[model samples]
Target chain A: MEHEEAKKTTFWANIGNFFKKIGSKISEKAAKKAGSSNKTQMLEWKKDGWKATVCLAPALIILAVFTFYPILNTFLVSFFPDYNYVTDEFGSFGFDSYALVLQDATFWRAMGNTALMVIVSVPLSILIALIITVLLNSIKKLQGFFQIIFFLPYVTNGIAFGLVFATIFSPMDYGLVNTLLNAVGISSVGWTGTTNIPYWAGLFVITVYAIWNGLAFKILVFLSGIQGIDKQYYQAAQVDATPRWRVFTKITVPLLSPMILYITITSMMGAFKSYSSVVSLFGESMGNGQNETFITAVGYIYKYFNRVVHDNISWVLSRASAAAVILFLFILAITGIQMWANKKKVHY
Target chain B: MEKELYFASDEQAKKYERIRKVRLFFVYFFLTICALFTLIPFYWMLATSFKTAEEVQRIPATFIPLQPTFQNYINVFSGENAILLRYIGNTVLVGILTTIFEVIITILASFAFSRLEFKGRDVIFALLLTTMMVPGEMMIMTNFTTIARLGWLDTYQALVIPFVASVFYIFFLRQNFKQIPDELYYAAKVDGNSDFKYLWKVMLPIARPSIITITILAMIGSWNAYLWPRSVCVEADMKLVTDGLMYLFQNEVGGTSDHQIMAATTVVSLPLLIAFACFKKHIMRGVARSGIKG
Candidate 1:
């Protein structure tokens, strides 16, 4: 009778264990469902974060296709033989294009002319800008009107202004400048005709143009810098009976250094890449008289490309690519040097 | 002795006063001269514009036109050269549209760069800056071909599309946006506001100065733009004011009618001059701030 009772108890226990297993299985299924929902929410959050990139991609790709890709292709084509734009034939990779560019006298002459211009123009612009800024700061009444007048050169039509200046600097007394000189009992000078003189004159006019164009902005920046200085410092120096020269040298010079550095770098870069004014001055028949002043690196690039499209036709891509690469490296090296110098000088 | 000492002090004071007054006069005189020198080009252009063709070519060129007439201005507005008005319209339209597009692209890109934390974000920004450092001429040839392929030449798209997003402007706006406090973001998050709403309400208002600055810069840049317009707008009807002036110089044209071209130039430059007059302080401040930051 005892053995029969033990068998019945054992069967009931086994049945209870089976029910517990089924309950546990149901809970596990529910947990899996909950985990997947969490994952779905995480993915939605990810999409939210990536949304900006999605919006920016179209613009970036357009920029790259239009800007970056062409630049790379141009660089690549520079290494090849006679690239024809019409045929879209980027011949093959070789350094022949570079060799032609390096050997070309006009290319070197253009580079030299641009270098002479930058060497002459950049520092003069900086110095004159500083002087003008100092003088502009000292003025008080009708300051706004004067500032506008100073900034006028920058706003005037450069091409038209180039024409005006051309007329003024015209070799004969009919020119405005020569007429003025004759009125003042000075002999007429070939302001735009003599090779060396015109080259230097072009440099002078370009520098003056840059300086005058830059003056108003530079003055405004300098004025702001000066205004930012606590008046107390000047007052303190005055009380201590510091010499005016000392005060200017010790206070104003140091304070304006950062702005000076900025203007310097920009002006230097502008001078190196300058072409528009030079091109305007000497249209096509440059290398005659003062026409030699027309050969900026950028102008050279334009000339090479234009020459290719019209005459050579085959080497357009290769020649342009080589010129651009060289120009790019030249600008990059100058800018790098400038930036390094700026960092050393621009004390906070 | 005491009386003599007092008299001497008074005389010395008087002498110092005279010296100061003399110094002030010379300073003012020097400044006025510089100011006049600065303005002579405009004066010459304007004075030449109103003169007859003979007066422009006259030796001892008249400092002031003897018989100033509105003929040049009228010609530019009504004669065969009447496209001056169209040129102005084109400039304004291009300037306004370019500014709008640039502002939008720059603002959106700036937000992404400054606020968003994603993979490769910094790297992308650095790459953009690298492009900024490259000289602009390096890419012009390629950009020209790209536009040709896209068939965007002679269209406003060619003028406005390639430069719609400026890396320099983007970096500038991003720097401006970064200066905002992060607690604002936390507060918005606590309110369960979406990130877009948070940026729209909180960050944008704080970045108003930068937005305005970028807009002005874009406008001025587009307005003054020469080479790109001259390159892309090969057709006469599509020319900008700067390019239109080139027509005044074309050999087929008279090429050097001083009065008409100068008058047109003066007219072309009028809008910017007027704008500068109206907003000098803001522009100056914007320029100064940009120089410092840049």
Candidate 2:
């Protein structure tokens, strides 16, 4: 079967295999000046080039059609404020879309919300995860057992769990967190209340969810990093009767700095693209009767893209594309800066 | 002097031993609390999933279900709630098909990049690497236009096609493929094996673990996918699990319908949780490898 299928190589592959066979069947005697001609031959027709073409064609084509083309197309569409989605036409291009998007209060609020999610959630998660990782790394008994317990959230659906957080944080008498709050003599704070949900309340719940949801991966990364640190460093610290805080700071943290920075960067990046996490918490409206208080930039773009306005979808798409480009550039700049900082600051 | 530095006397050694025990106790105590933080949500999810509807909304909510029942699960699979069941089925079908095709395509591309002597292979690989840097969310708008042009909206292809060719998986599989010895390829050629045969028979066996990781990750990606599917496949039958979850909230379970929502989420989360438990080592190793690499 394999042989038959190999014989049945695609048209391009057959062309490549044909060239390969011809090239090989030529005796060295016939091409004694092989080294001189080799450059041209190699450039024009590499051995098994057909196979590579065949193997790579699907990915390249799919990526071209879906990813690469869309990038260029998005850039174009972002500029063409009147580009039509349904009709596949555009009026002469301008900066109308950027002008519109830049002026929108919702778009700016979405940006603010995304920034908040990143700034608030990323650092807190990193700190809490760092502490848990230290504890998890120090233990001897049931380490695997505890790890599996902690990793439970990693495999579960983020949407499901975000809703679970929503349900848990529901500011009702029966809500679990509310019940706990009542036990401490505080009343409900309207965290997920259906009407008049406070922006701060929504932000707090989202931050807590982000920290909880983001911890598993960060812990796993840090724990692995901690284990990779040479045991000799700790032994040396012990020999000197180094204080525990000193050991953690001078020896362990120095080595773990790279991983720390790594997790922070990834967490930030993940937070930047966050949509489902926020939507799952605040539902479709993102905040009922509160004017989209929890909506992120992606959610803003998503809202415009699926806004279902009939006559001006072109305007809608252009706005979304503009927002997307802004998002892309922000991510590129942030990642680039973080990477630069990571290199300069971390020893590893 | 070393002994004196470590412990001044017998009493000092005993005191240090006692301190060590106390410290260990505190460390375990701390870890247990953090672990409970992760577990309590799942506990609430499962416990509520089994509770009778009346018990779920009682003031000062019940920590444990007084009468555990499967009626909510039955409802999820029955009546108007059956749409949730259809969404789960759609997610599974889409996930499986996408993984199979993705694995095959990744293998072919990786094998080509790894072993096949091709013109512009280095340049193409570099192009792929750069493509990974572009955030995917930016492409959603134009890609939606393209898919609409292709008339694929409200279809399974809309959900599956955009995801099937991940450059990250291609790069990951290529790294594993490059690790194979050159002698193996030369020997396979001398033994008259074709490229496809060699990939199927030799390189694949060596790269199985990485391939399995890609497969698991792909399935998880599909299972958790929302943003694209939410925009494109908004039809009732075409929704993936995550999208349908919100649909469940909006169309089926209301704001106060906590028990039914718990039931739906539990059904969605169980297969994945069980799979991870059974394959914990493989999963963690895969995650660790990705996290450690640049």
Candidate 3:
């Protein structure tokens, strides 16, 4: 932890030094331009200096207004004990929102569901993607054709494809999966409906959808990483007549570790923020009537933001902000741990 | 040269050859199965879209539409679902405007960071990088409040403005920019060219591929954005395609017709599918580059 803290501080310090150096350079240039009585040279120097700021202004302003400001505002709003979102009124600040969020069972369920998604979907997607990529690498013909087919999912809009998935996994007897099951003498299952299906089944469907949707990109990345591996290693293995599985375990995996690490961190983050897939699977409520069976952290945040609780809009708003903060912290902690773990194990 | 290769005995070689053939067959078998799995959803979506409502609901579902019809497609563009066209219009407008503004700002910001020397350059860049780590959901409530305060709710500005300045795009473009040799900039300076002139005339043209990548990514992102647009654009006419589809499913029909929903989905996804087909290499390469760098 101390080492991490030191690394963070040093990062900031480097930025500080960079700013200082630029500051001195700008001042020195200004001094030289001022010393020169030539009007055009001074104007030229001034124009160059102003040009940089001009280029940066729009991005800085927009990012400030939209990104940074909102983050800080959300953090602050999470503390407000009684904040009216519509009226822009607030009582004295406190930790009531955070406390309320922590005490709420729904919040914990959302966190648990989000964790379940990340744990189940991320690794499963990676493993499947790796297997497919390795298989893809072995092929000499129709490689591009197979790649395009695999990557089709990554291009299509998630929600749109998700709508397709909803139908395939539809709880009705005629649904594709159900039809297949029944054709083999099994009964139809309620994948999404007001009743009949287990809650976990719906969550499982969503997880399966998530893993499938996520595979395209991971497969693409791993394919490229695998293809980029030096042919010499493979040739040497061939010369040694090393077994294919051994070649994969000893060579392909280690070489592809960096890409694997990259995919894991990103997919985990994406899974935690999983929203549209659930919406596609279970609709806006993320579950059948009156059941919050599959609420994710982001979905929970959206639910509270839209719903008025106890006829108190402020209460819902503050609670939503609190939930958002918790989600952020959860993501942050996971990413940090992943980075540390990858640092120890990943090969470049 | 070697007295005899260790594994080169005739019987052993034949056995190894047989194993290799078996392994190769399994590899093809596994790949074909996986590819089918990947393509099935797309196939089902398309197949369902063309099927009649009754056919879609038939048990032992037909893999091919028994009677393919354009009725669902027609339905999507008429009746209560006619608003879908408006949603598509809204999305196109947002995508175009957001891409233009986003690409321009990203170019300017990236050019400045990559090529121009200025005070606090790295500091500001580092600060921007930190923002990338913040989850978009965490900022949604606050951004929504901010939009509401601006009286921009349900407006195109609400959808386009907040997303116009992406740090990731700027970072990606900057990486591309830094690859151009510094000597060229000095040579341009020696030719009495202004910084902006050189940037517009020389640098941008050289960095066209990255610029295209940014444009494609920005457009796709804007097109696919659902949550923020759904929240901010609550008006019936202001919804984007995904949000509009959700609205259609929930409000208009209440999850009724699989055929109609699939039809609407196909309509929404078709453009992206076409674009991907046309620019598959560029998109794949861009994604790979960004993923590796990121």
Candidate 4:
């Protein structure tokens, strides 16, 4: 009787298990059917590879438009001869643009101008900024006030600042600066008009502005670098009777080398791209006496394009393109040298 | 102990204290001169703005305008210079919009960069870093053409769109984001939350400082933008403060006088300068954060 009862229970359990498996399968199928409405949902559930590719589409498109296409266009334009941009013809490609760019005297002159500005202005600004920074770092009273004044230039709109400069330095006697000079025994100098003085004047004013502007940030950076130094070193040095200058030279300068390199590179770049103010001061002609002051690699490129678009100097585009390529190469070489030199100085 | 070490005797210490006082005086003297050099240009702009046309051009210069006037300031506010307000509005709108879009895009991209174990991520980031070398000047021609093709010339679209994605900001925010603990990301994952929700809820609030820094940077860059705005918005109505100031500088229309130009410049710059001063702490913090790497 017991054996027969146990057999009956096993038979009932088997029947229940079979029905439970079918019900679970039906629910699973129903859930899958509900999720299959959108192609995205279907792919995500099944095709992981396709999901990733679709996800990356926006970023990839941005890269192509902003990075790849522009670089490719720059290289392609350099190879093509002067063609009507409107006509969209593939003019003869050779070293014609390169040859013309290389042979042009004005191109070299502009290169010289740009190089001069970089060589002269960058170091001056960086050095002055360091001195101002060091001084600010040493001060204790009204520290915030001093910092704000020094940093004013950094936040000042370069274009608006340029306007102020242009007005103050305008060549006309009615202009404030020229008027002041005349008030003295000096004759009115064309600060942005004539080549002999205006270029140097422009350089001086712009450099001052750059240095003043550069002071606050670099000061703060150097201050942070200074603050980070283990004060124990100074305390120990004092016990050893180390001179103040010696300690600074040995400890601070080496520690700040990395930041110095950054400042140098940025300053060099800043000098190369000093256009907003230059344009404001020199007008559309760029104080180049019909192309003289206007001959900077950047200024020239700016002028040519502005002219091409507005005044129909399409021929200048090839020249401008050629100048731009050379300018890029110039920057690459200088920055490469700067980095190579500074790399050894970086303290681990 | 420090005081004793400076001088073995009280007499010596007394003399040293006097010398220290003298040194402090000299240091302040030098600092004052430096500060003067920095402040004088701004003072001159203000002083010149207050002077009459003849007073501004006066011999030996009126260090303080003898006859102070609000005439120039009035002219700047008047309708003859209506473009000034338009320029301000344009700049504010561009700055705010770019900051908003960029912050959102960058937060998402930075999160992806920080947490996700994606293929070729480092390589992609490395390529983006290389683009930093491609100076704005190198790409100006192409950017201009692109804007023209988009039929966005003389419009704010040309000024704002190309710069909406800053590789530098993405890289910066990514570095900040990576420093966050991984537990939060995984916790969200275990809860079956999407990546977007995880970022919006957990990651963004943690990265507030960096977000603020980038926002300040983007806004300032857009606000002070001169060349791009000039290139794109050639139409009079599309002009910004920088361009408007340039126009005023070119035409000298605010009374055919030097004082008027000075006043207009002062007016244009005053808003930015004041805003900068008010938010000086925030800006300095942002600058210091970036300067750490710079």
Winning candidate number (lDDT): 3
lDDT of 4 at B118: 51
Q: Which stretches of candidate 4 lie over 4 Å from their true place?
A: A1-60, A170-188, A193-199, B1-6, B251-256
Model 4 error, position B213 (Å): 1.3
Candidate 2 C-alpha lDDT tens digits along B61-144: 889899999999999999667898788899899999999989888888888888887656666776666666667767887888
lDDT string for model 4 (B122-219, tens) is 55655665665666666776666667767888987677667767776776788788888888878898999877787779878888988998888787
What's the residue-level lDDT of B182 in candidate 3?
91
Model 3, span B160-235: residue lDDT tens: 9999988878877887898999999999999999888889988999999888888887777877888889888888
lDDT of 4 by residue, A54-73 (tens): 44455556656766677667
Off by over 4 Å in 2: A1-45, A308-312, B1-9, B251-254
Each candidate's B-chain TM-score, in sequence, is 0.91, 0.92, 0.92, 0.92
Q: Lowest-scoring 10 consecutive residues by lDDT in candidate 2 chain B?
A: B247-256
> What stretches of model 3 exceed 4 Å from their correct place?
A1-47, A308-312, B1-16, B251-256
Error of 3 at A268 (Å): 0.7
Ranking by DockQ: 3, 2, 4, 1
Best-matching candidate per DockQ: 3
Residues B1-294, candidate 1: write the lDDT tens digits: 112222248778687668757876876777778788787777777887899877776777677889999999999999988987898899899989888888888888888877875555655765665565566667777776677667777898888888787776776788788899888888998999877887789888998988887787677777767777877777888988877776555331112476777777788888888877787766656666665563
Fnat per candidate, as a fraction, reads: 0.31, 0.58, 0.59, 0.29
Per-candidate local distance difference test: 0.68, 0.78, 0.80, 0.68
The clash count of every prediction, one per candidate, is: 0, 0, 0, 3
Q: What tier of docking accuracy does candidate 2 attain?
A: acceptable
Which scores greater on DockQ, model 1 or model 4? 4
